[model samples]
Target: MKFSACLAALFGAVFVFLPAAAAPVDAGHARVELISERDAALPGETVYAALKMDLDDGWHVYWLNAGDAGLPPQVIAQPSSDIKAGAIGDIVWPLPHLLPVVEGEIMDYGYNHQVVFPFPITIPEDAMGPVTLDVVADYLICEDTCVPEQARVKLKLETDQAEANIREGELIGKWIAKSHVPFPGEARVLKKDLNWSLSLRLDGGFGKVRSIRFFPFGHDILHPAAQPVELGRHGATVSLSAADMTDVSKPLDGVVVIEQEDGARTGYEISAVEGPPLPDTSGLGPVGGVGIQVAAWKLILLAILGGLILNLMPCVLPVLSMKAFGMVSAVSSGHAGEVRRHGIWYTAGVLVSFGVLAAIIVALRAATGPITLGFQLQNAPVVAILALVMFAVGLWLMGMFELGTSLQNLGSGLADRDGDAGAFFTGVLAAVVGSPCVGPFLGAALGAVMGHSAPVVFTFFLAMGFGLALPFLVLSFVPNLYKLLPRPGKWMDTLKQFFAFPMFLTAAWLAKVLGDLAGSGAVAWTAAGAVAIAFAAWLWQREARLPRILAAVTLALTLFGVTERAMAPAPAIGASSAYAAKYEAEPWSASQVQSLIAEGRPIFIDFTASWCATCQVNKATTLKSKAVHDFFAANDVAFLVADFTRKDPAIAAELARHQRAGVPMYLWYPAGSDEPQVLPEILNQGLVTSLPVNP
Candidate 1:
């Protein structure tokens, strides 16, 4: 990719030089004429060339940098022998208007009428008679898209004892001063765990300081859009995150351009002097490395164990209590044998639920391929739906309705009319609810499984399912355990009512997750849904058909609101671009890559994600390394970052091309290569430097 970018740049540069039709002089606008005051100036005396621009209404041109994207006029002079040319200063720029572009923020400079660029000529100390000089001016004129304009203006100068007026010189001096950007003092780099801190002293008082923008010469060394945390007093101490810090050892070199609130601009070319290496505080105490690793492992293990432990979770506890109540009712009704049958049915329900989940996961895995390559089940819509489902279940559990009938009917048709199918579904629901809370050992096991082959992944999930279902399975097989339970009584009703709190809590959690996925509107919808559910349950219990209809209508409205909220546009990820116009991103293809390489342009490829934690982590870390940046700058590698963070079909196709289903994938194409070289999950400075480039 780097090589391809370099080639693209080369091609662009070459294309810039190709002969083309000269932009016609706008006869409607002001015209400029170049003439020397004297044929030649005497040695040590100044000679002058007059540049006059014709103008139309509301026309102007500008100085270099053009504030943003418009180019400044260039004057190249060719002098004959017996003549010496002094410094050729920049042309004066009138105040320019800001032009907005489609893609990024860029300012352009040009005049509708005409402008003049004057330069002084110094004669040599040696005697000189007549001198001839030819000059050419290349400039860019723009109304919307810029057009390069060039013209040749020839003149002859003879030795003259008298000097030209110095008023033009004074004007040029003033413009030069205005164009100059003041330098700020140097700064020191302070190293932290995952960020770099810079403490710099400004020459002027803090009162003069307004907004500061740091432009790192190396593109990938830092996130360009990350807002710097500024601590200002006598001096400013800025902390920059290194989540995208690529090379730690590499020095930071950049320009800190500070724009005052008053519109005054000053700049500092800062080289971040390295601070002392951070202390290896790894073994400080129980709270250090050992603890962190243990905690991480504990979380992973807990996830695995939680799957097994979920059978005992509060959600399942209520169902079990209800089942016990039913069993007691049966017993008193002279159906004691039904207890054994019910237990077996519940066990079957649990296993079948596990098997169903396993099958779904397996099917998804097969459909999507490797998880490591970018498989994410929780896309925006999916997450919203999952949250909604959980919230609905929570409402049901909270006695929003007599969910018993619906719950029983859900899996009651399996095998016999046994209530065991409900138990199985409960098991499945438990596992689903357990997903967000990754318990100990489960994280490591899950991480491992995600990168594993299909069989291994399936086996791991199977083990997790078994673990989750184990408790229910064991209890179902143990009739002695049922015998130990207290006799069914009024206490069971109180317990059933008490179990509603857990369901309410679960509902609250699910609502919160929904809010995160779909925004505050989702939260509002869920809250409304909860109220409706409660009312619906009350109406159902009252056996009032009219109230039940109203409750159903309310529930329908709430669901509709949730669905609408889920479909709303999300906020964009980063700061918008700063360009005169934004270009539509062309699909990356081998041919395009080859073309870019041939052009000698640099490319930046971003492999990103909306759900991937690691992809974001890399963007914050190694991809932003200083060494990687320096390599790119030195090679002029076009920086193209492929963003796979969202559901971009182009990115998906690219991933498919690379045999990947997910992101954190990288590919570098050197100049002339039809294919791109794959990069590793863990980016390194060496890997960046090792990228092939064409001269």
Candidate 2:
């Protein structure tokens, strides 16, 4: 279906070449030109030509299919006897911005800047002389007032001297790329009171559309001024007002202009079936007593808040504390400049990491279907690697080995080369460690990104990183805060060593996650890798050049060997598994969920993963509590666990269906309700126990 939609958009969009140009002629408030795509065309060749217009500020011209009350620009090609003009194809229209003419009366779709319309001309083999073409163009330019415009441009083409204008060719190419075609999914039109409502179901990928607008190509059908587009995650609906009730069953065709979250504009040509509107299956749309749609700006703010709260999460606290102490040490050392520089570097690191992470997620989602949040954690090799990394950090903090002389002086505020590097990596570490524990504000913000454009998603992630770094940034600039920290002493060393325990605990937790993914053998491999890492670090620190080289080789071999070993196959789903033993809920499947729904039983779906610290915490507390279990039992709610410890396309789709990128998602479906209520990231017994149950 997606491939067919792409082909429909690409049909008749072939590129042709031609040559010729005329000086821009001033017509009303716009400048018009007849430009050719090539220098000259040989006999029996098709020539591509374009009508270019540069409109004055605030003034616009109509599209080929002018809606409601505007005239479309017209082009008449009269070639001399030697050259015959073929039937011009559809004018390649650039996506038009919405133009409101009268208050609540008329909307015009057109262009205000540079606009290009492409056409093709054919020359016969029997042509005798140089081809001479005479073109007459007519258009209406309008701002507050409208003006009739006309231009006649003549072009002489010489076969011997083929015109090649690189700049003009590039400009035309850019305009062509910017032009949009029809969406590659499904769209339908339903008859409403004096109007038709367009409902569209777009394919899974097109990363987060910021907004969309529709331009009706037919006259006396859709009311330009009154149509409004309502956007959802996977679909959009627009009300098209009609001129009269005459045969509304014909397929509705028009161009859809979409502005993505990143400010990119594209268009699609759609031919929608005229029928009764289909039922809304996409959960993104509104449902009574269910999820509420959050505004974009609000989502951004929530992302920031989520990032701010992440500093306090158990997964991130240890690394954050170390960074904070380092910042304080710099402040107490009277190196104000160093403190600010370190803060800036740290912020850059965080923002860059977030940008990269968002890019990877968006790109993957576009290429493959939906993917879970922290997708790396779902891989056995990744979990094993992360465990080793955490263990190494723990060793470093415990003084098993020093990074460098400069980095060891953490109290001096990484002012030197090694120290600066440390600060930047620390920022990166914060992002990595903090990911497993979804904060209260982060869940919705991250979820929103899954449903929106790439740029919008990037901005959300950036906002989060900024929020996470904001506290340290303030402390670096504010000298008063430095007084709160005790002076650099043995206690500083003791505190650093004490923090290593948390790192070790985190490493152990990741090892458990690895075990759950690739079986118990992967845990053994991870432990063995940790031992090799310690031995290598010890040898490198104590020995000379040759020994250090050997140590480096040994370390590399150990890492690769362990990752490979940990990636070995695990037991099947039904086999005895650690995850199965740990959780009491029934395994979730699409069929089971649908069956429960059909049976009129309320459902509680826990979308979770073994690696997610937040998921484990919630499972141990709110979910397992007797009160919540009793409430579910009494209400006849089927408890299903959608475990995302490994990659599952169906589970990924389910998460995407709910606009979630990652898990620890708690969904409550009241009996007889089609929509499920999305719960907060953090949960308590009361929150779960109090859910409304329909009898």
Query: Who wins the lDDT comparison?
Result: 2
lDDT by residue (tens digit), candidate 1, 385-450: 545555455454445666555445567543334344445455555555443333334433443343
**Model 2 spans > 4 angstroms off:** 1-295, 406-415, 574-581
RMSD vs true structure, all candidates: 23.6, 19.9
How many residue pairs clash in all the candidates, one count each? 92, 13
Candidate 2's error at 434, in angstroms? 1.5
* Alpha-carbon TM-score of each model against the true structure: 0.37, 0.58
Provide the clash count, candidate 2: 13
Model 1 spans with C-alpha error above 4 angstroms: 1-306, 309-356, 359-418, 451-456, 542-557, 570-695
After TM-score superposition, the amount by which residue 101's alpha carbon in candidate 1 deviates from its true location, in angstroms, is: 33
Q: Write the per-residue lDDT of candidate 2 for residues 114-189, one digit (tens) a residue.
A: 7987766665566565676677778888888888889876666666445555666677777777777657888887
Model 2 earns a TM-score of 0.58
Q: Positional deviation of 69 in candidate 1, in angstroms?
A: 21
